[model samples]
Target: MEEGKPISNIDDELRQILAEFMVEVIKLEELVEVGRKFLVRFQQALEFLRRPSIYESSDLVKSIAKANETKRVNAYVQAGCLNAYDSTLSVGQLNTSLSDLHDCVTKSKSIIDELKNLMDKAGNALCMTSDDQLETEIQASEAIGSEKLDGVGCASYMAVIYSMVKQDYVMQEKIVSSLSFKSSSGELESYCLMWSLRPFINDDIIRQALKQVR
Candidate 1:
């Protein structure tokens, strides 16, 4: 996660998954379509998991007990909002289902965070490209230095670059296949980093980063 950023955005791995859908200049409609599909799929999966998560018990209790114990001791533990877990558990108070709901809500919230991040990226892509005065505003707001370009402008450029890549059928399929559970989070982080760079870095630099990842 970015410093001071509370939610998990797309990590590199998920960005790579997104790259397959990108082109040098992706249409806004296409971006929205892809995002909608992902959102729907995530919602479906969450729904599928929700029932078992609320109705089932044995395993969830053990996990939550261990997790809470870990959180209690480790001040630095990176975790989701306690309120999400707390509210779900509070409703079921005396029941084991409380733990189950906690686990389910936690996971679902993370997925929702990703969806929010995706929408941000899509919005960034549009704002950076369509707005004429955005650069001036950004330039005026920040000190005139290297860091000036490292904000939304940079992320916008990265989004454009990903869209520009001429898709290779075989390579794209392979890239998608490589994203197993073990590497998914990392890929998401990578995608986020690549696209989240300062806009001044230019296309060649972003392309090189993509090449190395490939």
Candidate 2:
């Protein structure tokens, strides 16, 4: 009976750890969705700032375009239509968008930290169980399908996702920070495209993560 008690305890610990891991996976999925929304908002702001009228009306844009006579003709002609173009609205929108993006970055950082902690805990738990036992327990837990993960596979999967998300957020921060009155229409277009494409994030991994939650 005494020897069996250790086995029972290990089983209980495994079950509890797997349960907690699944909950964290769900949280990660939700956090990723929030990031997606932030990206959409950022893209919209970029699009608005990129409009020909808004872009050409900026005093800074005019100054830069002046150095290139070819661009100056188009920019000045557009600026002429709105002789009293006030940049206050554009500036305000830019400030608000940047502030919101900063908030998103903070939240993303928090989520990533939590994921790291969870991964560590999972790693420690992995030490208590053998490969075969861990695989069996993971399959029994049914949080993620047998084909999806075995042993520390889920933890590694989440780590990969967290890494990608962290990189994506960093990229977004750079793009948003770089935007200014001096940004050319072409630069703005590229920024918007990059945000939408999210080259750092993989759709397959995202799908796999989503399946874990369900």
Candidate 3:
């Protein structure tokens, strides 16, 4: 970041990139809201379709179990993305981010594992459904929502996973890897992370966050 230079400096590029990233963050917030709703409703749907008299003999329960896993994996990926992105900025310049990305990932995994439990519960209830209800809820919902032609919960979870993890976390990893640094080891992974977050985070300040966390 030299003074009176016609070319763009790192600070300038960082501001530009951050502005772009915020647009996606806006989308993430909305998707998270939608995800929160779907989790609740999907659970309710399973509870209703689980009545012993209704689900006594059916394969519909199986689908619910699968959907639960689908959703859990999606949320888990999102959590990973958040951890990765935050880590990029959290670590110090010329130093690895203060918080260990793997540690944060481990903590996040615990929360996401709950989705697995919900799925198991739904599966047990589905087995009891009679043929008619199975036809209605499991096979019949094909025409229920706007996605009449596509696979159901799978796509929803897929989209969520792509948004939270790949779009931000995995993608950012590539950018960090691409960045070139001066006179430093991979410790400069910290500098690369800070580059993406330059707009709101002063270099010195981010340096401290990385140090504090470390």
Candidate 4:
């Protein structure tokens, strides 16, 4: 960003980074498409395997239910730990009031409790098979795609941020500082980007998509 730097050089470098970021975005889209297809096939497999007679007689249903429950708990615990890390950063660097992480975790647990209550009611009202649960999960996923992933504004902004960060050390520091200032309460909002994106990242699919691009 220095005045003396040649504008053409800067433009060329920026264009390169922009192209790379767009390629990444395209790979992500392809990964999402493959993941959707995988999910559909997985659901079909579950449906074929979870016929009423088979599901009632076999332990597979219970095993899957338990596995899903464990997965959800592990996800929540990981999220809480990440939140704690963010709070640590805030307290250590920003000299902010130490966040009450216990309270935050408790609030998260309360939300889970409410969801469990809803699930219980649904379970009582209807017979739930693993296939049915798979369908419900797919529906919930579609809802999330509609609610959060529907917007490209955040993605484009992120691409800009990525390009900025790929610049020289001074520029990166300035960019981070400016972002922190623009963020709420001087907190580093950028720290949450990768964590927020964890749910959407499919490493295997991404790898395959990248291979295609290469």
Candidate 5:
């Protein structure tokens, strides 16, 4: 920003609001779709396992548990929060659900932070492309930056059933195969693949998956 030039013009301010609003709308719609996935997954888990989570010795757990135990998972504790993973099933499953929720939360934070950086370019008399164009670009930029929350949350949630709590070979494979859980880009690819698969993942599951994400 120039010393004499203003930090932002009225147009820039309006465009920023519009851009963020559009992003929120797209996010909400995607969330509604993703929410369904959790329901389906939880139901499947309920039917298959006949249990929510397998008991494990907290002593044998990884360092993540020690760290995570301190930070409260924020999504399911609220009223009317129908987390697919947070069903009244098992304590073990709840942990996995929390992880799933956290995965989406982390991805959302990344995208929102990226948007903040992108918005930084819009400062000081920045001329925004029309809303249509801006929307497309924002989505494009989001895809480039995000694209993983959907998959990671879903895949990892299932993994919790096997890898985290249950250690059930059959269910673990089922979860992996169900989601085709390959993530070439590690975390980044994880979020994208999940996002791409959001429509098919079930609504409740999607919502639970997105619990941790902002």
Candidate 6:
């Protein structure tokens, strides 16, 4: 009976640890969803900023600028408009969109920070050897293996995805911050292309991650 009791206690402790690990996995999934939402918001703002015609002719942009007179005055002066009302109007719309994009990027930074902390906790919980090293080793093929990932493998996979996403977000923030009325068409085109390409983020890995969650 004594031996049986010890075995039972060990089993219970193992179960408890597994439960905690599962809880962290669920939390990670939830945070990933939230990060997805923020990414969409930031993408929308970037798309709007990319297309001058869309914002320039947008009644919504006009309404937003009209609601904020200070922004209108600042845009007109900073854009270096002389007497062309149409040019001033376009510049005002651009400024408003840039401001919105900046806000989205700022919000995304907070989400990324939260995700980084969560990934660290998850890695520690899984007793991973080294989060930094694992991040580089774990690839889409490994993440999408036929067998289910062990605790350490799962945590490492998530860390890799998080690192890529964080890098992509940093790149996006830099691009958005660099945009201005003085930016040439070529620069704007390059910015749009880079955003669309998303060089840092691997689509296959993200798809595999989603599959794991499902």
Best candidate, lDDT: 6
| Least well predicted 10-residue stretch by lDDT in candidate 6 | 10-19
**What Cα-based lDDT does every candidate model obtain?**
0.38, 0.58, 0.33, 0.35, 0.36, 0.58
Q: Tens digits of per-residue lDDT for model 6 on 58-105?
A: 688557656766966556544542335654565566666667667767
Q: Alpha-carbon error at 67 in model 2, in Å?
A: 32
Q: What shift in Å separates residue 38 of candidate 4 from its native position after superposition?
A: 1.0
Score residue 14 of candidate 3 by CA lDDT. 31
Q: Estimate each model's TM-score.
A: 0.20, 0.57, 0.24, 0.27, 0.25, 0.59
How far residue 21's Cα lies from its native spot in candidate 5, in Å, is 5.6
- Please identify model 4 stretches exceeding 4 Å from their true place: 1-3, 54-214
Q: After superposition, how far is residue 71 of candidate 5 from its true place, in Å?
A: 53
Name the candidate, 2 or 5, with the larger lDDT value: 2
lDDT string, candidate 5, 96-180, tens digits: 5435644544444454444444343442223443323333332233342333332222223222211211122222223333332
Top TM-score model: 6
Lowest summed lDDT across 10 adjacent residues in model 4 is found at 95-104
Q: In model 2, which regions exceed 4 Å deviation?
A: 1-79, 83-86, 128-148
Give the per-residue lDDT of model 2 (tens digit) for 138-195. 3343455534444355545545655676687677668766766566667766876777
TM-score ranking, high to low: 6, 2, 4, 5, 3, 1
lDDT of 3: 0.33
* Backbone clash numbers for all candidates listed: 20, 0, 8, 0, 25, 0
- Lowest summed lDDT across 10 adjacent residues in model 3 is found at 149-158
lDDT per residue (tens digit) for residues 66-91 in model 4: 57667655554444323445444433
lDDT of 6: 0.58
